[model samples]
Target: MEERTDMPSDPTAVDPYGCGCTECLTGEYIPLERATEVHIADMLAGRLRNHTGTTFHLTADYTIEPNTTLPELTPERLTITCPDHELTWTLATPRHRPLEDHHRAGPSLEYSDGSARVVPRHRLPS
Candidate 1:
């Protein structure tokens, strides 16, 4: 994948269709996780964006590992491990507020086909 420095970092900016529920309003909400998964799914589905343009029909062989638990947070934090490579990310609830629903941010992801790739919370195209 080509690197584009101008890519948006905010999840909402990249994915317009959020988790579609209250599960996304707090910290790394379900909406965010779903959005992230959608991106990976798109990649696997061969739906690749220009990374610099609005064209959204690219193809690539990809795999997405669901969120796993990080050793640091143990049973509290939501972490996902990618067995394909050495990468892990933690999802925490918004500061001070507890998750209203069972919703929580899924694990952070790292993709390693040849290079290391971290899927941003946003930047997932529909």
Candidate 2:
């Protein structure tokens, strides 16, 4: 992927139509676990953009997991998936006000045919 000089250095600076971010312009994939709630919130708020130059809205759902904290505390899970694309991510976070979720995004890096190559989202055929 070719790096674009006009891309936004900060993710927040990019619009919902994710054309100006390094991920969108350069097809750089970041681990979902490294993503924060702010990133998910941005997606929910039509602030997070995808490589397609469009806003991707993420849906939040509650799930049950092993409670490692207090007995009264429960772990919450947030799953984000793109309906029109092969994109899915999950964030395991605490059920508190200041929620910090773990998530991973971007296309698959594993591609085997005869050579080693990573096919970016934009490079995929429609």
Candidate 3:
């Protein structure tokens, strides 16, 4: 008699790119560059709201100074942790073109902390 072992057979489980996982559930196309922008915007907004008691509206064209150091996006989702606030945010790239880009470009987001992420536009939900 031969002993048999059970193995997981999900494609997402075996995916090398880290797509098809729960972390990447959105299945959106977000490039690395774009995702970072979102994260920075969110962090700045939170800080302003918390410390100054004022709400700041974020625009896509917001500029991130070249001196700022942020995390790089991976094939899987990006997680950013803010040391000051101890907040963690998971960013998913937009699958479609950003509304401001005439629906032809992907968008990215950044969370609190110094982490940033981007997903390509084509990966977004149709």
Off by over 4 Å in 3: 1-74, 93-107, 110-117, 120-126
Better model by TM-score, 2 or 3? 2
Residue 113, model 2: lDDT of: 38
Top-TM-score structure, candidate number: 2
Q: How close is candidate 2 to the true structure, as a TM-score?
A: 0.33
TM-score of 1: 0.22
User: Can you rank all candidates by lDDT, best first?
Assistant: 2, 3, 1
Give the poorly placed runs of model 1, Cα more than 4 Å off. Answer: 1-75, 94-100, 103-126
lDDT (C-alpha, whole model) for all candidates = 0.32, 0.40, 0.35
C-alpha RMSD for every candidate: 16.8, 14.9, 15.2
Lowest lDDT block of 10, candidate 3: 9-18
The sequence of per-residue lDDT tens digits that candidate 1 reaches over residues 6-55 is 54433322222333543234322333224453344333323533121122
TM-score of each model, in listed order:
0.22, 0.33, 0.22
Which prediction has the highest lDDT against the true structure? 2
Predicted candidate 2 versus true structure: per-residue lDDT over 17-44, tens digit per residue: 2234456444342333343445543444
Weakest ten-residue segment in model 2 by summed lDDT: 97-106
